[model samples]
Target: MSANAQMVAKYKNNFLKEVQEQVEMGEWVKMCMQCGVCSGSCPTNFHPGWEHPPQEIFMMIRAGKREEVLTSPSMWMCTSCYNCIVRCPRKLPITHIMHGLANYAHRLGMAPKMQPTRHFAKLFWNNCVKTGRVNELKLSMGLYFKDGFGQGIKNGMAMKDVALGLLKAKRLNPFEMLGGHKCKDQNGIHAMLKKARELEEKRKAIKAAA
Candidate 1:
């Protein structure tokens, strides 16, 4: 069976339980009281892409709408402004839960494929993790070229003035395209990240077993 299928069977299709056990800080999802305060407080509340706000997401989880919740682009829309968390009467860690849901959906390969936020997040994470530092130039190029060469050229041209300004300010380095500066202790950084991944996997395994 596919990993997702196996997980579905293992969880007996109980998406809420799966989320609670698998997602970061997901156990707190039950604390939501459906007051709509979180939805109202969101800065992106006016955004049409927000198909379901925080409280609605929690409600969907409780209602067992697994596919709808996981595949929706709503979670990816969070900007992590934390307005929902601050205004929530239950004091729920709403920001963490939203990100947790997004991460969980990504891991299961269930997130919307074309979601811009998810795409940018993947690009940013890969760019930074490689050298333990961000190569801003390469990151920007990657984003520009994500659609196609034609679109990428257009994007670059459109941002040419901004790029030139950055170059003049010494903020953008063209040489970074070749190889940019990296962390001094590259091996140490890689080792530390590897160890962290191992610990995280072990923790998840224990949670799954429990």
Candidate 2:
């Protein structure tokens, strides 16, 4: 049988089960009705690349299109605006489910390499891990320069207007961005994060064993 056929077979279809086990929000995905309300509510739906909206993604999960669901640009496009959740007749937390899928994709090393949002998320986490806080300058630099120095400069130039607006509003302090900042209790933060990671790993192991 083909891979798709195997996924459709009763015993081989573990996709939904796996999703429910791995992502807290994934349990609600079974309730999706493909009504397209979630898609209509999403701000990113107008973008050309988001082929699978929340409803389609939910159906994909049930259909066991594991790689396609994981690599989909639709999952990465969610802004967590809560619009989908608010409009969902079933009251499914579409925003949370989208984020859960993204995290799951990253955890399984299936995340699409070209996803800028994923890149920013990793950079943001790295910044938080090192200092217990995000230094906007460093985070921005890491994201812009992620591809390379030349790309970074180009990205920076593209955002010049937004940066200038931020500076004018005092939201982006030039001095702080240049100097960076550290948490007051860096050791305590590290210890907490380490414990959290350990617990998360334990949880994953238990789920896998099940």
Candidate 3:
């Protein structure tokens, strides 16, 4: 058998199972026609570092390359320009699928080690969820210090000029970092986020029980 056929046969159960899971995760990916339009429209596909564009990612998903797909850097490269979606003959939500796959990978604890974007995204989300606003200084500190204090200092030094510029422009506050800034309706923000999380958990439970 050909290599493609061999892989499918070797992991037939996983292939079928993950295909069904992904179809349920992002329904539109199930309709991918392998037309390659999505990857062709994707500017990142030309970048040497980008290994799996939308079409290739879907194919990998179908082929049961679960670990590779989850660890792929390409998922984080989507620019959300919607070029693929606009051009897709199948009308697939290609951009959404990319984001979905990234989230799915992170949720499964399969994201590649030292994925800076993933770390940054989690830090950003946590800050936003806590205050209903992104405290730039806190977010930056969190991201930089995530690896450790030493790395944080190094990162801060690297961005010294940009940080100074922001400070000069009054875009960031040192005092807020210490005193902590918060939304006026902190209670309302907490309530809304709690409700959203509860709903998300409910959805996950339903999916798990299915």
Instruction: Give each model's whole-structure lDDT.
Output: 0.87, 0.84, 0.77
Worst 10 residues of 1 by lDDT: 6-15
Predicted structure with the largest TM-score when compared to the true one: 1
Expressed as tens digits, the lDDT of each residue in 74-117 for candidate 2 is 78888889999999999998999899998898888888988777
Model 1, 29-75: lDDT tens digits are 98888999999889997888899999999998887788889999999
State model 1's lDDT.
0.87
TM-score of 3: 0.77
In order of appearance, the predictions have TM-scores of: 0.87, 0.84, 0.77
Question: On a 0 to 100 scale, what is the lDDT of residue 105 in model 1?
Answer: 91
Q: Is candidate 1 or candidate 2 better by lDDT?
A: 1
TM-score of 2: 0.84
Model 1: per-residue Cα lDDT at residue 73:
94
C-alpha lDDT of residue 138 in model 2:
85
Clash number for every model? 0, 0, 0
